[model samples]
Target: MIPLAGWLLAGGSLASDPAPTQSDFGGAGLWQTPTARMAEEGELSFTANRTRPYSRYNVTMQPLPWLEGSFRYIAVTNRPYGQPSLSGDQSYKDKSIDLKLRLREESRYLPEIAVGGRDLGGTGHFGSEYFVASKRFGPVDASLGLAWGYMGNRGDISNPFSIFGSRFDRRPGRDELPDTGGEFNSATYFRGAPAFFGGISYRLPSRPLVFKLEYEGNDYRSEPHDNDQAQRFPVNLGVVYRIRPHLDLSVALERGNTAMFGLTLHTNVARRSEPAKVLDPPPAVRESAAGRGADTAQVDWEAVSRALEDNAGIRVSRISRRDAELFVTGEQTRYFYPAKGVGRAARIVGNEVGGDIDWFTWVSTREALPVAETSVELSRFDALLAHDIDLDEFRRGVERNPPLPRREHVLYRADPPRFSGGWSLGYSQNIGGPDAFILYQVSAGYQAEYRFRPDLWWSGALNANLLNNYDKFRYTAPSRLPRVRTLVREYLTDSRITMPQFQLTASRRLGTDWYGLAYAGMLESMYGGVGAEVLYRPFGERWAVGADLNWVRQRGFGQDFSFRDYEVATGHVTGYFDTRYRGINVAVSAGRYLAGDWGATFDVSRVFANGARMGAYATFTNVSSRDFGEGSFDKGIYLSIPFDLLQPRSTVNRARFVWAPLIRDGGARLSKRYTLYTLTEDRDGDLFHDNLDRIAD
Candidate 1:
């Protein structure tokens, strides 16, 4: 009469605790499983149970939170009559499923620090656990764990008539080899000892009940009965019992060599259920009778900026018919967390605009500027020009701008018109330069994406700009334009102006199986900067990976200086409204610098998915004149498929060429910019589809 397959059920506060008559229950118990939260949002659950012989089921799902998908099932109910029935039906059934996720862990309010990818289902397929980092020094509350699993099934005890006398490893042996190979083998196979264990658990603060102490054991394979390796050890003693207010109850006692006892019953299920006469009422009298019967609330700041640009994407910067007098200019930067000798640079400006010839739509913004808040004073080697027009063929390309027709007689090889210019700037060496400082500026922008739902995806932009500074006059050798330096002569008469700026940006994509995303915004110089970032990709493989970081802050007007430990501010006019407090003049140099700038970039023909293609890359940049310098270093190694110039097709003399051997400086010489030969003779030459006639020729 051992038909006690109770499949777990032990509700909380069991008679106010203390009443262990039924032999203290047996190890690892706390059943009453059925967890939930929020109801919808990709739900899933299952439960099944049968009788005779066997039949059980359990299933759960979420899809993301680092992913978790569980499964369990068992079946067996007949056969078993002769000498352990070799293959003549003696009962067989067992199937399992476990696919847990979370490649990284270290966030219990940051316990010393941790980083991504934890057990990508390596050892023993499933049964992964990790907790580490613990503290409660006073009354104990310890923690430290790392357990792996694969003991898969050890159940079932039912049949008709036995031969009496057999218990192998459970200890009763005395057959000395009989019953045809000890009852037809089969003590459950695959015991391949895939071990690795480390454990620690503590808790003792009793008041109504609390006392836990655990110890784990492991050592895979050393033979204990076929299938290889077996060394066990387990210890646990528990008693917890808060009992109410969301309930909880525990009961544990385990000690290797087959001793076990358990019972648990925790409950919360997204708590909330206690307001049946607990002082309720008064939300200003339920909103004063629905605001005196509705209607009378007006403040539609453009429908709250189009409901924050369609439910929290916030992108605002409309006004650009090429240049409707720059009403949107932005610059807000900050990243202070490095201060010893000093070295940090930031300058981001992204834009997007829409309407006309809808190359798929727009509205964008991105601003990040603050290298001492330059008001022009730039020159390291500069030259610029960039453009993009598709406002529906932008007035038919400005009514056929440029000697009518020349853009390949009506540019439109499936929607053309995108441009860009050349000549970047750099140079800043007080000691062989390259210690970071290459600000070559010049831009023109517009980008777009507007979808309310389609699994929800969004992006927008707009940009307008110009700049040409040869980095403080490259090498200052031929210097004569008011030049004088005793330690930086009033920033050399500040003269770096070509100001006409603007920017905007937006993004969104949230939940379905393990989804998440949210972002905030703002950008409009001297005091207009805001930022946010988040990402989670539950399950998508080919060695999938995830993690992201973002931050921003700013203030500008210019007149602050302090070099010895860094501190610059000399442009003050603060009191909040139209505030001002300038940039740069902070110097207190130390050690820890890994300045970066490794040239060499070549990409010829593509084919390297596994080997060979003629590719070359090397770009490492570390900046630190003071703050823990080693803050940057990008590794590189590349080689694409070229299999010794793979034979394809070539025909130049008759207007058909596919030459690709582009290399950047290894023997010097890489210049070919005759205004991109009038944008590859106007169109379809596919040099990126004449990107807006090479930025408006």
Candidate 2:
């Protein structure tokens, strides 16, 4: 049987297999062992499973073709990490991370092969490592593999690696108690006695249902906390029902006595449902251009600015005309797509000015910093408006140039207190911790922005608590470092109405590719700071660099503008890269964190054509594991959904949700309101090309 391991690896299956569906364990699996199946790229899945002694919640994503990543929280029903007298009845909840890599795809003659590690980080309560293979025949899919560590605790057979040394006969025991739990314990991997686990899944004919049967691997003798469970039979049976295209439900009878149930919700970030749009009518094409008696010199530039705002979604700061070219310097205010906004503004220019105006130049600006200059020829505009023209060809004819070094002329300028506001209802929660099993808050907030100048603005937000259970947030994880964070209860319970942000920001365009900003006031819920940032981004480039420095004082516990004595100077030198592969973007930053710890952070996100984004980030600092406490480093996942995905009209607003396992002091970065990379996203050539279908709007 030990030699069979080598033979199995050399043998091949006879048919190609389809991708596997998620099993009760959240990844592609049958029962206890994972199968050689991978989810579609950009797929995000949330799964919940419950059995006798454990409940698991998983967030899984397939960011690449051969990789699957899952972050999970497991709750042990009968085990408590804290005494009941102090922390109320709470089950021990542990956070674990898992990853699987596919080595070979199923072909006509070979089975799909994969290797994976479960519970790779955190306490090794249920950790295991395995190599598995699967093949499909008609509606029946079969999987088989050998598992080590906790999965093979039954010791049904001798360790195959023992041939190398007797030390490989027994797996090393994990430290029962560790100061921090996020480190991977690699010494014990593949060192234990191995056991066999296999299963078969059958799909019901023409029905959205699947049945599975598997042989157990573990004997349940080494359960956490010495609470070993009883295994009456070694076989397990299960069934899964597809409730909807994005939803699934599963149930299983395990060990002849225990029952398990699971629910999964899945979505693909790369695809979205197109909504019916009620769009503004396109600008009317000029009929007999010579008949419209419009004087270029006598045009009401102020009213023309107002017309541009109302019709074209462009807020003109200054307008100038030199020779046959009319230049409008402004910011985009409405359309989410920059090209659509520029095209609309150009059409408005052709309609307001006479045909003698040979060119319309749009100077795209942010905080009065010129980002790019777009020149549209009147001839190309007329042809696109009247004739059947390819938008790409027409755009090629339009000139995209760097901003001019000097201002040509100032024909008109307008300064007004532009007021804009909106309100949203939000809910936040913390789960799977020794604190309360769940602490949550529901709040409603309103934000208002007043633009005093093209480069200066004031903004503030006030949130009113509608409902909350923050009083239950009493338990705080132990930490040895300065408490830069982990004071959630103090901050959440300080006031019913809290102002998270109120600031005045001034920005300037230092050069065509350089921009700068200075901001001060209450920056966030816990910090009040003055900061400055500078960025250098070339037009239509794949990479850029930036640096930001801030001097911040902690806010008072009352959630007011008063400052605390705790202050820090922190900043990062960051680089941004567009991989130009599957719309992936990567950012790397290295700097001193809020806790005075030096560290680096890596972030990778995917932006769909519709502007929806999904990403995850991880940070590691110089702080020792003992000082950092549980979750040795900071890590989280986030999703940014565009408002237009649900609304009938397009807008620049987005609803963002982020989740971090533990809020420790090791690697905390300042959460600034804006960044130059985001502000100048439109300057990317791919963005304009992706949204060219909206050129007419």
Candidate 3:
């Protein structure tokens, strides 16, 4: 039997093994020793219980003063799996790990402030979890937490309900249960929710009673499979009773996920230390501004991705989930004439937003522009505001438009702003291999523009495609990158052109960091290109240098089918530079085109960074394939710098600038750039100029 001397009493009762009273529920306790005392703490607890057909075991330990960890693993090997079991068979297993740490605080301030991390055991599917923080001041305590969680089961539990009742003969001789339901994949059961939870609780002064309340819910947009856009809120109330000097019991009824009845025992690890009366140190004099400490280190892209899905189920399975969003864009270009239309100025504005909820609907309106232009403006605005709202994720989506598309053309007054309204929808699901998945997307949009060559002309394009990525082999275009980011490759096609194209790509790991890949895509445009590249890593590292060779052919209005005139071949050597502090990557290349167009190129970017990031790009191309234009060795240069303006403690501010100069014949060709800004969460606008050479000439 447990000793009773270590335990204290509440409300005049002194039972040998006391039950928790209402006071102990929320952090309320009567002083047993001195009113003000210092103390060290260490504690451990283990519980084993049998809830009818199933048995559970749980353990909690605190190895450090500010850290608490808990582990719970459950296994049931019975046969009756009806009702809650879903699977009639009787084998269910799950394990979870939870860790929490307290932050440092002054003696007079709240000391219960803490950060929490959780990882579900290798049971359900990939791992899923959340980050939470809480604080308590005097008789009041409150907490807030964000959770990105995936709920799904892992390996099949031997539950009678899960067994296929029709397929297996089950004539008293079968050992393995036949695959009946065929819906065992975790994807079928797992649901994704982005939840925010916060609540307040208060204690009654001088009484053994405490009152507490909380609210929790998720904000989830529609995905390819599930379109439920709903939020949940629950409430809870509980009380605790202190039996002896060392034992405590508690019970609570909650409408939310934490609803449970639990009993706890508390003991003084060591006698409370005497209160100290040390003199307060004088405040240090303020000096010049100092670099913020690591605590001020901002959350980068990698941190956000890791927090999204970190679970055993997610780590083990090869299933992927995707979301489809639709948006509309409108932009206008203005041109400024230098003496005689030598230079032009332009401006672009757009509003985009749309999503589907499972049962309802969701919509948002925001602005978007190329990265180079957005980063610059954001930097100035960030210095003005005081918060950090991620704008890079949006910038990333806009950069996929090939660098030269529409950017090389000069603006005309007769033409209206570049106004386009388009819709894009895509969805992808993963198969069961380690990293296997299938994806598809359909996009169609129209733009109204006055064609300079063909006066008063308008045109539009429609797009549709499917892609697959499994543990075995996958295929995509050269423009496509690995789908490691969000399970979806941003490119519509690979490196090859795709009016209507098909491709197959496969790769295999040779060791740790070494891998080999092969890809082939068919093109439908009048012009087509066939190319292949090999990647090699001598030391098996994440970074590597490689070379590629490509031969292309083009058919123009007048083509005699001559190699010297219509066929072209080129070779390029490539290397990558990765930056961690600034969250950027630079890919540099030196290549030669058969048509005397040989130059070096560097494509660098500040991918995910705090404050702001800028990318300076420089490229020179001489001579162009007749298909592009009728010109002799032409020299061109382009530059763009991007950044994220983080307010002191608010959403991000963004801006950027892009400039390209081309020297043809003895003058500049289409020399100009643009600047874009996104001030509101879902609003965007921009300003641009053309014929910039007028300033130089």
Ranking by lDDT: 2, 3, 1
lDDT of 2 by residue, 1-697 (tens): 1121122222222113223567555688876667888877756677788988988877777777788887778888898859876468888887777889999999987899999888887677788888888998988988988889877777778988899998788887765446477777776778779888888999987887889999868888888778798889888899988766666788999878899898776666546533555775454455557655367767778887887787677888888888778898888777777677777787777777776678998888766677778787877777777666777668766777778766465778877559989998977787776766678889999999998876789999999999987777777667787777887678888899999999999988777788888999999889998999999998878899999999998998767778788999999999999999888899999999999999999999887776767788889899888788888788877777666555577666776766677888889988889788777765776656777666665
- Model 1, position 115, has a per-residue lDDT of 14
Say which candidate scores most in TM-score: 2
TM-score of every candidate: 0.19, 0.89, 0.25
Q: What are the per-residue Cα lDDT tens digits for candidate 1 across 75-140? A: 343523123322233343332333333335434553321111111111111222222233334554
Writing each residue's lDDT as its tens digit, candidate 3 over 65-117 gives 55554444344434232334233333444334444556653345543444443
Off by over 4 Å in 2: 1-20, 155-169, 278-295, 298-304, 319-328, 357-361, 374-387, 390-395, 398-400, 406-412
Model 1 C-alpha RMSD vs. true structure (Å) is 29.0
Q: Which is superior by TM-score, 2 or 3?
A: 2
| Model 1 segments more than 4 A misplaced | 1-61, 64-120, 125-149, 152-251, 255-316, 319-697
Once fitted onto the true fold, the runs of candidate 3 whose alpha carbons sit more than 4 angstroms away are 1-40, 46-57, 74-91, 103-113, 124-128, 150-193, 204-210, 218-233, 256-259, 268-697
